[model samples]
Target chain A: GAGVSQSPRYKVAKRGQDVALRCDPISGHVSLFWYQQALGQGPEFLTYFQNEAQLDKSGLPSDRFFAERPEGSVSTLKIQRTQQEDSAVYLCASSLGAIIRSKNIQYFGAGTRLSVL
Target chain B: DQQVKQNSPSLSVQEGRISILNCDYTNSMFDYFLWYKKYPAEGPTFLISISSIKDKNEDGRFTVFLNKSAKHLSLHIVPSQPGDSAVYFCAAQHNAGGTSYGKLTFGQGTILTVHP
Candidate 1:
């Protein structure tokens, strides 16, 4: 695809179950980020990946949330033991550069909506 | 505590008119600000951005103004169109060095409705 792509647009999981969401960033992009958006709220940053290195994970709410980008192109966000509060849209974004450049804009993917019942 | 806040939950404007959306942030270290537009079932699309050093940045009909002293920013859309109706988000980043990276702290978005 020409832009960032995310898999499993919708996922329904029972409480205590685990789920994994995938994101395929724009080809050759070096930066990737994951955010979670609850109902009627803005997306909150979760983690960031620069190429294959996980540089920042400060915004992650809990230890149950995990993300990785082994090759720096595709990334995955996994939530363990889902709770009702975990039900939200998980968004993925990618930028071309690692530093703050003049045109470093992050392009987002149509997020994966998760429902924890 | 909410670092970034968009107090107005919604805004309505008529076509061909100007629409202003406002945001405020408590973090003084933030140096980069961005505005994003999102549609239902779609991801947020980048709109405009302004660096803390500049008070204003303009791109076509969209302009973003920053007030460092007030810790506030506003996005102006001139001649609003129906297509511009969507949720707008204000995001801030502290781009000091490697410590901050590009993680964005976003404000609760504002819903903009453009009536034709």
Candidate 2:
């Protein structure tokens, strides 16, 4: 793909329901990131991946939030027992290289807006 | 605590005028800073960036000025256009090492409205 892609642009889930969001990063990109953006706020970091390795997960809000990039090209973010507080836009981004590299500019997807009612 | 802060929630400017947006950070470990512009229903688009080694960086009309001593940074858009109207966010990254390498700490966005 020419840019990062996210699926199910909008989702409506009931409280306590589990939901999964998908992200497809640009081809050959080696690094990927996930962020959560609440209403009227900037996007906050969630997790990061370097190929198939999940190098960072400290930003995950709670045990209910989980993410995986099994094949490295596509990633999935799953939220278990979603609550109203989980309502936010989930964003996915990918970079050409690791942050230590000078060319590590992140490109973002349209993101999935999840509304937990 | 908010590691990054953009005190102004919104700014309005006439087309062709300069639009200056300010940001502040408390963490000294941030070695890279970036600005992102976002439109409604779309994800943020990368605008410009600067490394801590330099105090200023410019790309066409977009310029980012970093004052390391004050822990402040500002983005100046020369001859702003109506198309530039959107929410702008300031983001900082810690690339020194460790698991925090790629994590971006972002400030609350500032909505900019450039009127024609």
Candidate 3:
């Protein structure tokens, strides 16, 4: 794809229900990122990946929030027992990975709007 | 704590005028800063970026100014058009040694309304 792609443009889940969001990054992009954007707020970092390696997961809000980019391509963010506070937009981005003396600009997907009822 | 902050939630500007969006950060570890423009129902698009080494960077009609000493940055758009109305976000990048090392800290965002 020409840009990063995300699935389920919108998701409505009841409280306590589990939901999964998928992201398809640009081909051959070595770095991928996940972020959560609440209403009226900027995208907050959730996690990052360098290829298949889960190099960063500290941004995950809770133990129930999990993300994996297995095989260094497609990634999934799963939230267990969703709550009302989880209502927000989930964004996925990809970059060219770390480069010496260069800025790493990320390309973003349209994002999935998750509304936990 | 919020490392990046956009104090103004919204700003209105006339078309053909310059729109200046301001941002402040607390972390001195940030090596790079970027500005992103976002429309409703769409993801943010990279606008312009500046490195800590330089104080200014310009691209087309957009220019970014960074003041490392004050931990402040601003984006200036000349001849603002109605189509330029959207949310503008400021982001700072930090690459340290940790699991979430190379992450971007973003501001709360500023909504710009350009009137024709």
Candidate 4:
């Protein structure tokens, strides 16, 4: 794809249910990131991946939130036992990693709007 | 802790006038600052960025000013357009002495409305 792509565009999960969001970064982008944006708030970092390596996961709110980029391209964010507080737009971004010229300037997807009922 | 803060929840501007949005951060370690514009149901798009080494950066009608001393940064849009009305967020990044520097901390965001 010419830009980052994410799916499903919207998700409705009941409390205690599980959900998974997917992201397809720009072709050849070495860095991928996940962020959570609550209503009326800016996107907050959830995790970062340098190719297939999970470099940082400190911003994830809990252990139930997990992310992986196994092949260094497509990535997924899975939330187990969803809670109402977990309802938010999950955004994925990609960048040309380690390139001084790009400086990790990220390109984002439309995001997956997750609603917990 | 909210390291980055956008004090203004909303701003109204007339078309062709200038719109200014402000953001402040508590972390002095932030060396890179960026602005992003977003519409409802869409992710943010990169606007412009300024490094700590310089106080100002400009692209098209948008300009970003950074004051390291006060830990404040602002975005100015000249001749605001209705299409530009959306949520604007300020983000900061710091090199953590390793490859983990790609992480970005963002502000709450400011909603801007440009009416004709």
For A92-113, candidate 3 gives per-residue lDDT tens digits of: 9998875652556799999999
lDDT of 1 by residue, B35-99 (tens): 99999999999999999999999999999999999999999999899999999999998876784
Provide the TM-score, chain A, model 1.
Answer: 0.96
Candidate 1 residue runs with Cα over 4 Å from true position: A98-100
Clashes in model 3: which pairs?
A: none
Better of 2 and 4 by TM-score: 2
Best by DockQ: 1
Candidate 1 docking DockQ: 0.82
Of the pair 1 and 3, which is ahead by lDDT?
Answer: 1
Task: DockQ for every model, please.
Answer: 0.82, 0.79, 0.74, 0.75
Compose the digit string of candidate 3's lDDT tens values, residues B1-116: 99999999999999999999999999888988899999989999999988899999999899999999999999999989999999999999866755555578899999999998
Q: What value of lDDT does candidate 3 attain over all alpha carbons?
A: 0.92
Q: Can you tell me the DockQ of model 4? A: 0.75
Per-model i-RMS in Å? 1.1, 1.2, 1.6, 1.5
- As for candidate 4, its clashing pairs are none
